[model samples]
Target: MSEIATSEAAHPAHLQHHFDSLQEQSQVASLGMWVFLVTEILFFGGMFTSYLVYRSTYPDAFAIASKHTVILIGAVNTAVLITSSLTMALAVFASSEGNRKSTVNFLTATWVLGFTFLVLKGIEYTIDFHEHLVPGAGFQMAGTNPGHAELFFSLYFIMTGIHALHMIIGLSVLLVILYMARRGDFSPEYHSPVEVMGLYWHFVDIIWIFLFPLLYLIDRHR
Candidate 1:
């Protein structure tokens, strides 16, 4: 504990001076970060539950909508995002070990993969638009489904649209982190910002993992 205190004392003013120890600081930061993640899960949970309820109520609509969805594109995006998560993990590892150069390289790789994912998502959205899958904008009216077919497209747009917004936010955060890294703002001792951001990145990846199977790969065998 004394060694930790000494390390904290020697650390820079950028870190909170109120914290008595670096370990405490890290623990608090991590806790706060995880709490934020929990809230994020809740935010998405509402939509997921709504999807389930609607799917059950309108199984035929759900199946037809699912058929129109590009599962292949979703699968490719999943691969892209998982690869980005791996690189983001490596970036955190590099930061922990004080290899600033490697950290930068890994972050760069992550950014590339993130952009790739976004591009593919954009293409998918465009295709959906062309296919008249969007609600109120030329919807195909998935068969004579018992329930409201329009509701299905509405839910689809709401869910996927919110997710895309999150991706944009993540990309912006990564850019800020990259700029700071270029400026030597982080070191092995006080890269809590990077660590927190990494946690967020991984959480987003996990969300997409769930989304892929539910939204794309589902048999929707109604």
Candidate 2:
């Protein structure tokens, strides 16, 4: 239609040349992000499957290992991540509303919270190291199931280590977004980057949601 054509002709700076309109560009970006997320899910899925297999085989050892985890630290990090997700959502919302200052503020808050989560995770890792829970030489778990307990720690490190890597990458992405936001790069008509980053952040947060209960709360009811 002529109206659509006219709108396309007024394309925002963010619109790529390959895309005919901003809406189309945004849709494509969203689809791409979703596809990437699917791959991420599959990647983590393999780890989760391994965990389930081992956990079923060694439920008692797994429970004992889980008991050794720092529950308070895990709980605190969960809260921190959840709060960061909220700030991320607000950042996306602010970008969509063309509120530059608000966008920067929210993104900065999200970044800080994310950093806090990582710091807490580092503290937990230090405790794990001192407790000899690192899944290799110097590893120490008592009782008759030390081997199975080692397996539990193995999976725990792989899972949480991968999650921490993701957090690091997410923090880097936030830095870029924050810089762009400060430069007034996003607007009501063009905020795909913010939106996609928000999606990634939320996905990471959801992973932690699953992880917290699995890794830290397994033996709590007992």
Candidate 3:
């Protein structure tokens, strides 16, 4: 019992006693994160399924409502998110290389880009509200299917609102990770947190990628 206890103590500070090795600890952490993300996927998947059903049922209304969306802002936000993903990926790479300075710099860039995306989204929402695009008693649309248009806007707000909430959570996590990086919490052998965060960031960005075209470019060629 003493030998076992001493052996555990001899391990690195980051390696928990429950984990036999650093590699094992990293694998466990990664598996846990993946499981959590899968649950998130199912949550988002239900919304997607609903969107498809409603769009198919009210194709014209959906298309017209989509046109009211601010395509320019949506496009710009997509670019910002894509850029942030790049920076996040670089941050993960830097952390795994034991380059603390580079990791902090990349993380900072990612956070800034993410903030820009949220700001643009806020402006877009403000424009929607001013234009009476929000689905409610004041919702206005000059079409035969105003009710259907309202439904489209309802889905729009629900889906994007949830996505924005996820972004807020992600930003909070990034802030903590950034502080940890500044304190030299990560090293080549122990960067699972960074890697796991990269997965989540990429997932959020991909969700937006799908949303941009669906909400802003529906039947635009018409």
The C-alpha TM-scores of every prediction are 0.90, 0.94, 0.95
Candidate 1 per-residue lDDT, tens place, 78-142, comes to 99999999999999898888788888999999999988988998899899889877777477753
Candidate 2 lDDT tens digits, 97-122: 99999999999999999999999999
Deviating ranges (above 4 Å) for candidate 3: 1-10
- Give the clash count for model 1: 0
Per-residue accuracy of model 3 over 4-55 as CA lDDT, tens digit each? 4455447676777677898999999889988998998999999999999999
lDDT of each: 0.83, 0.92, 0.92
lDDT of 2: 0.92
Q: Positional deviation of 163 in candidate 2, in angstroms?
A: 0.2
Candidate 1, superposed: residue stretches over 4 Å from native: 1-11, 220-222
User: Could you give me the TM-score of model 2 versus the true structure?
Assistant: 0.94
Alpha carbon lDDT at 197, candidate 1:
91
Worst 10 residues of 1 by lDDT: 1-10
Better of 1 and 3 by lDDT: 3
